[model samples]
Target: MNSFFDGYVNSKTTLRLFVNQYENALRDKVEKENIAADFHSFKSIVPCINHYDIEKQFQSVYTNSKFQEFQKELTRKIYYYPTFIKKEGAIEVYQVTEDMRIGDKRKDVVYDILLNEEEFEVKCSCHHYEFRGILCRHVLCLLREKRIKEVPLKYILERWKKNVKRKHNFIRCTYSGMEDTSVAKRFDMLCNTFYEVAEVGSISDESCNALVEAIDKLKILFSTNLDNSAKDLHVQEGPSCDGKSKTILSLVAVRSRGRPPTLRKENKVDRKSREKMAREKKAKKKEKENNVKGHSMEIIKHNMNDASSAAGNLASQDEIAQTVLVNSSAHYNTFQTA
Candidate 1:
């Protein structure tokens, strides 16, 4: 760290260098990712092991990595078997049992599956789709049993689609030397949209002609609107020669030439102080809790003592009344005898 700082005149320069290097690394990583995606786009897809239409559909739609995950589920579906349990209206209940082997010990794991016939929707107790966004072997086995040729469109998430355009890809990187303006971002978005449209339109002559006609109409409308906007701006300005020049004041304050105030680099002393404060706060909290608990216990003990004393006093009063009654009865007997 000292050697790196020695190369720079000030900490600010060092920080700027560090930030530039980090951005460059990020940009390189993004480029690599793009290259990989392009490679995947050109590469031939892996042949389906099961040769199922659903497998081929997934292979075409999903990225290579995600498709491999689906393929694994497809291969593993053999271990799962779905048995019809009962039917209730449009929904059918099936008990799917997976024969899984772990370290030579085999166990049967049961999962409940609900199939909606009308909607062609299926849900499994395994919750694999809910958690991983991928269908589980149990669901696949059930689908196979039901003879569903293709996976539902709802199940194929856009996040895993191979040809899906991501907004972040068009955003300018910090080290790219390009201004990250809204106009540039909008242009990139429009280009991506047009590229996708062109790809689709090229599929047939009718679509190509329709797309060209629509673009021509849009161009005419945009040109008319621009001409009207320019005329209105010209009218609003009145005359360029008659406009007065106004002076703009400079900023009152300039930013300091050092590390930014928002960025605080914690050293050993600061970290230790923070840790010490945290420990003290925790100790104080624990002490307060203990005091509260002790106070509660004291109150409970005092209440028990008060209750015991009151019971003892009642018992003494009863004994005194009994003694008085005995004495009064003896005296009455003596008088009667006299």
Candidate 2:
């Protein structure tokens, strides 16, 4: 103790003791009186924090349960007295210890916190900020010990903020029509829109069934229309490569007045083939219905015949029973007379 006091006197360390003691006394008084500091609204207390950062902190603290738990932990006396080591540059280091004891266990967790005092940046060895995008209790405790009244803006990550997705370019449609637009582009748009509707409709079975029925109706309508309009289309030769004529002809529509060149006609043979296919389908469906009805009628007739046979057998059994009773009565009377 004498050597420590002598070293303190020699190094003139006690010169700043009055200021440190005064801050400690004020903190103790605040704690004793239950006076709380409003970190959100205390703009002048902590450095490098503005109104925008305050709003972001509020949003993150309220919405994130983990952050709320961290706040609760910050209120507890978990961290030990932080020790600072000043370096030659703007970066300084703080050592913090936590009493992680359970029922007399002496386990202590220590962390090295790095702070750029000039830039108001803080980081801990736990990597809580790196992994979870939030300041750890070690850094928060050091900040409190240093008399910082508000958290710095650099500690508040953008991802946790409520206004993260407010920008217009975050999710924009990429399906603008262009000269290079192909079937794939239309297909991509189709899938995007279809999935949006499907996701909503998939919430309930009724909605899903409604969507399915609507799609079925659309399919029928499109198929019938395509079959009816097939004859108006024609096939023509397209540009070939390497002086080779391509066997596959491109289907082009017969031009009409006031019609765009992009319009293409369906092949006449395709229309006839589609009509034939539809007729075959109808014929098969009718045959299937007739077969089902015939099978049902045969089942009914067989059941009726079986029921009549059963009724006749029951009647014969009753008649036989009556005859046996009469014979038994006659035998009894004869025996009595004898």
CA lDDT, every model vs. true structure: 0.75, 0.58
Candidate 1: regions farther than 4 A off: 1-13, 101-106, 176-338
**Clash statistics: count for each candidate:** 0, 4
Clash pairs of candidate 2? Answer: 233-265, 233-266, 253-264, 253-265
| Cα error, candidate 2, residue 6 (Å) | 75
**Residue 60 CA error for candidate 1 (Å)?**
0.9
| Model 2, C-alpha of 210: deviation from truth (Å) | 52
- By summed lDDT, the worst window of 10 consecutive residues in model 2 runs over 233-242
Give all TM-scores, in the order shown: 0.49, 0.31
